[model samples]
Target: MEFTPVTHVLFDMDGLILNTENLYTVAFQNIVSKYGKDYTFELKLKLMGSQTHETANTIVKELDLPMTPEEFIIESKKQFELLFPDTEVLPGAKRLIEHLHNKNFPIGLATSSSEESYHLKIDKHHQALFSLFPYKTFGSSDPNVKRGKPYPDIFLVAANKFPENPKPEQCLVFEDAVNGVKAAKAAGMQVVMVPDQRLDKRMTTDATLVLNSLEDFKPEIFGLPPFDD
Candidate 1:
């Protein structure tokens, strides 16, 4: 299969860069269990890559919980604040990011997280790794991004932030969620997906390329600089 050459790369932060999916699962479970609801992987697949308020709304509606989305957000934020600081960089995430940065490739972050939650996840742990990104779009917080993933707004917003303002076809998105892959494709960009193993194989069909992990990626195939190590 031939891969199109790409000029800039945009990344999703949660499962792609940080091993925080489990932490989110823990947090979500903690909240939903109060209502005697089970937070299942199927629900997680549907919710991944959604903005903060969107996620709370989905969970409230999906589980028929006894709280408003606002109340759910308040509870979720309490859990996130306590849990997110323990976030760890995923395997191969730092290596690939540093490789792209050292090669002078323009890379940006586009996360569904609000700025407050984003900092809670990365500030104390992976700040330096994330600092390599010159541009970052916090979908839940950026008024310019009116919609989140599955809408393409965040990826489109991120690509526009590049100094040269590349066309959608010139940007490559790296994501770990089906919603993100759909968003990237809808934005007319190619996406490399490194999804969780539990994700249904059928859900991965929209990705331009799918990998087991970022460590398995070869930048040269996408016309980027090859890794020295």
Candidate 2:
């Protein structure tokens, strides 16, 4: 029940740290719409936290779209970049990062996004926001070659980065997607779900803590004061 006991924190980038899920949704819909298929919000939610090719294949099969997975990925990435040229960190993200960094806790970013796309979304400004974190794990960087989200590969990779003797139970994962929660749970880590626009009832049940936003998180939850100053 207590969260402050966590030693390391792992974060999911897109919907969790950066508020870009909507942009992804818009891009997906725009691309699919050109082929006469409707990519509803409900459908987009199903694709959340999935790998680019996986999501594209899902859409292709579901809508019987004509494009190949590779084409879908290429076009979708282009559209997303154009639509979201600027990125913004979610509320409380900077504060939480600073708080954890001040306490010398190791931080990791575990995202299903490709390294190139991830870098594009997180430009120079966004990098400064997360400059304190010492570790990162990307879907493109992992070698296990397993499915993303709803699967534990990404989280497992990040968790393994801790000192060789670290216990899995001591790590905490911050996620914003249902699949991300599932991944963390499968990885045997305590998870906090900070819901963005896509969170639903089913996703909340799997989380150790389901919060409306990171704004409500405080260091005291980990037995520390609100701020050092």
Candidate 3:
């Protein structure tokens, strides 16, 4: 396969760079179980990479829960506060980010998380690693974004923030959700997906490339600087 050299790198935060998906599962399960329902992988696949309100509404409707989206958000925020403080950086995330940063690649974060929850995930354990990004676009809170994954708004907004305002094709996105890959592709960028093990293989078709983990990424394949072993 031929690869084009990309000038900018964009990342999806939740399941991609951070291990917050496990915490999210615990939180969602705690909520749904209270209503005698289990949070299943089918629902997770649909909700991944969606904005906060979108996720809340989907969960409430899909599970036939009694609570409104507002109430669900309130309850989930409580669980997140308790669990997200323990968010761990995923494998190869730091090493790759550092390698790219050291090589002077323009890196940015485009996440479906709201500003409030974004801080909850990163404020304690990941401040330094995330600080590598010169800018981060929070889809749930950023008015300019207007939409989340499966829409190109967030990725387009992030690409515009770069000093040079790179074109969409000049950006290389790293994502871990079907919706995220869709969003990046819609924005006309190439995306590398590192999907969850439970996700259906067929769902990853839109991604320019798919890998099992960030540890398996080869920057040179995308025309980025190679890591010095």
The residue-by-residue lDDT of candidate 1 on 1-229, one tens digit each, is 8899999999999999998889999999999998789999999998999998889999999999989999999998999999999899888899999999999999999999899999999889788999999999999999998887899999999999999999999999999999999999999999999999988799899999999999999999989999997
Tens digit per residue, CA lDDT, model 2, 113-204: 88778778877558776667677777754666378898888887887777753567777888988888888899888888887654567758
Model 3 lDDT per residue over 83-132, tens place:
99888989989999999999999999999999999999989888998889
Model 3 has an lDDT value of 0.93
Estimate every model's Cα lDDT from 0 to 1: 0.93, 0.79, 0.93
Name the weakest run of 10 consecutive residues (lDDT summed) in model 2: 220-229
Query: Weakest 10 consecutive residues, lDDT, candidate 1?
Result: 122-131
- Clashing pairs for predicted structure model 1, backbone only: none
RMSD of each: 0.7, 2.0, 0.8
Q: What is the lDDT of residue 18 in candidate 3?
A: 94
When sorted by TM-score, best at the front, the candidate numbers are: 1, 3, 2
Candidate 3 local Cα displacement, residue 143, angstroms: 0.5
Q: Estimate each model's TM-score.
A: 0.98, 0.91, 0.98
Positional deviation of 155 in candidate 2, in angstroms? 0.9
